[model samples]
Target: MRDIHIQAIRVHQYGGPGELKLEEIPPPVAGPGQVLINITATGVNPVDWKMREGMLARPLPFIPGVEASGVVIALGEGVTHLKVGQAVYGSVDGSYTACAAADASRIFPKPVHLSFEQAAAAGGAKIAWSALFEEGRLTKGQRVLIHAGAGGVGHLAVQLAYHAGAYVIATAGEENIDFVASLGADEVIDYKAAPFETQTGQADLILDTVGGDTLERSYQLVKSGGTLVSIAGKPDEAKAAAAGIRAVWSGAKSVRAMQEVARLLDRGLITPAVRKVFAPLSAAAAAQEYSRLGGPGRGKVVLLIE
Candidate 1:
């Protein structure tokens, strides 16, 4: 048997980013339906911090990180389509590490023209696209409102909706209006200056990424019989029934959805924005700063593994 050593960030107890411990461990092996990847870059999402703090439900002794881009090094039995040395991107367990063993179903071949950083950003954007375009059934020419338009998911949602022929309205902090607009949003509202519900009246679809009041307010902005799809919060089913609107909380993790994202990425219809890059050793500090910033841009904070 061959042995390899790789570095990963692990958390024994959940709290703040300060709790992350960097350690070296044996490189992961591919199991049935799995593939080992030499991770080049990993995209950091809000969920990483949430999971780290135990706010999200996950098993303990967790290795945090969601999205990554890398090259396939090994494949498990039954995995015949993907070959070693092929560039691929996907969501995986413990993406912060130098090497990751991911379910082959969650992986996709990376676009030849895209850099590793861009592919990393695509990981989170693809989930957003699946939620808004696939499950939400967003249509062209309809008015769609996306919360946090400059965010990893929101930015892509804006572009996808625009490409789909929707009149895209997006909300973001004042500093991000231009960035959101550049992503093809028709109207950019400053979320702090005025509530999104107040700025954009009834819409055909409302994509909510911020929960709590933001999620609640979204209901009021959707026209009667309109749909409110949330990736961050659970909608009020009772309220939706009363208002004649459909509300749902959607998550994207299926193999098919990941493949769809890969297709879009390969076509250059969508791209990931990278905001910052940090060494694997600085992952804890990066997480701390990310949480502090509240995740500002569509740009992804990445840990460069290689």
Candidate 2:
């Protein structure tokens, strides 16, 4: 026990960003198989805002972030893979605080070439990798369509699929067409210009980060025997069955895939595009809101705790 308190943004009640309150709280201790971190930065994802809105239920007064980058401050009993003072990045349950404890396996050594902000920003790569490879089973030479190509996860999905030899087609607003294209997308369709289904031909796989109508429309674009994977929500199974394709909702966390993503990032084969970084931790509300609206900027939004 450190016998010290830290500032954190907690959600005492489920509502909107207004419910995210910054308050002083006791720093959490590392349990066995866990590591305590002095969080320097956190990645803002839709899941954070969704959890704030009560879409994902948790105990009251819990901190509200899932991905973070920081230095290891303490190691739990039996933990030896990582040493104190080493920088790392990984999935965290409550990252919206000055310090947090994470599963030892979840945290990976931060790449020497990556800043804490970049490491935090790159946390979404795990989700992207899981959706594209593990769930969607994307392979080389296959046509894959990814929605919201400029988003936190979508941008990374685009690059990963493209580099994997998949013919990458991504849907973005006109302003982001060139930006998504630069991320290795073979084609960037301006969704505002028209319905993406019409602009994009049939695909072997479709990764939907933007759900609802976009997901509903994507069913028709997957060829027979193709797969549609959604991290946003559950796809309509009836529609998928009728279309003769597979529709799956992916929420599973892949630690192995995250390790591979870290390797790719370290080698410079892929990179995170951090669009905006908010400072002082109090800016978490604004950062979450910016991520929710898919702000004027492209790629990930970050909250710099320092």
Candidate 3:
């Protein structure tokens, strides 16, 4: 076995961004149906912060990131589909490191047009597709409402909904209203000035990226036979039935879905809203943490892991 010590971040106990620390750790090895990737870029998403904040179910003593773009360095048994040295991007366990061992199924070919940072940005966008098309059953010519339109998921959802022929409506702070509109939203709401539910009457589909009261209020915006999907909070089934709409909490860990996103990237049907990249794990983690808490919360915060 090759001895590999890599720079990585680990959370021993969840608390805050201050708890995230960089250390030298053994690089993950490819197991069955897995491939070892030499990570080039790592995406810092809300989930990373959420996981650190104890919002996720994953327990302590786990590596911190999930989205990365990298080159395949090794393949374990039954991983004949991809060759070593192929550039790939996808979601994986413990991706906040110089190398990651990921299930081969989740990895997808990186489109030639996308840089490593761009590919890393697609992680959240891919999950947004699953929420809108796969779970929400969004259709063309429908009215689609996407909350937090400038967010990692919402911006992509806006573009996806727009390209699908839906009338896209988005909510964002005043600063990002134009940014969201540029991403193809038919209408942009200044969510700070007014409540989104009061502005949008009804929608065929609703992607709720904002949870809490925003998620609860979304039930009113969904059309009679439409669906509201969220990656945030779980919905009350009884309330959904009463409102005559389907409420689903959706997520993606799908190979086919990642492939679909990759295809879209190749064709230029959708573009990721990537604003910045930080070099090194410690600085990247801190920058992402600051952005998640108080900085401009639009686009993706990526870590250049090389």
How do all models score by TM-score? Answer: 0.94, 0.97, 0.94
Error of 3 at 13 (Å): 1.4
Please report the candidate that would top TM-score against the real structure: 2
Worst 10 residues of 3 by lDDT: 285-294
lDDT of 1 by residue, 1-306 (tens): 776678988888988778788888888899999999999988877888888878898888878888798999999999988999999988788887888899888888888888888888776666677777776788888999988887777877787888889999999889888988988899999989966667767888899988898998788788999999999999999999898998989887666767767777779887777767677655555754674577655567777877
lDDT of each residue in 136-176, candidate 2, tens digit only: 99999999999999988899999899889999999999889
Candidate 1 has which clashing residue pairs, if any? Answer: none
In candidate 2, clashing pairs total: 0
How big is the positional error of residue 223 in model 3, measured in Å on the Cα after superposition?
Answer: 1.6
Superior candidate under TM-score, 1 versus 2: 2
| Model 3 per-residue lDDT tens digits across residues 73-124 | 9999999888999999988778888888998988888888888888888887
Give RMSD (Å) of candidate 3 vs. truth.
1.9
What shift in Å separates residue 157 of candidate 3 from its native position after superposition? 0.7
Which parts of model 3 are misplaced by more than 4 Å?
A: 1-3
Pairs clashing within candidate 3: none
What is the Å distance of residue 13 in model 1 from its true position?
1.0
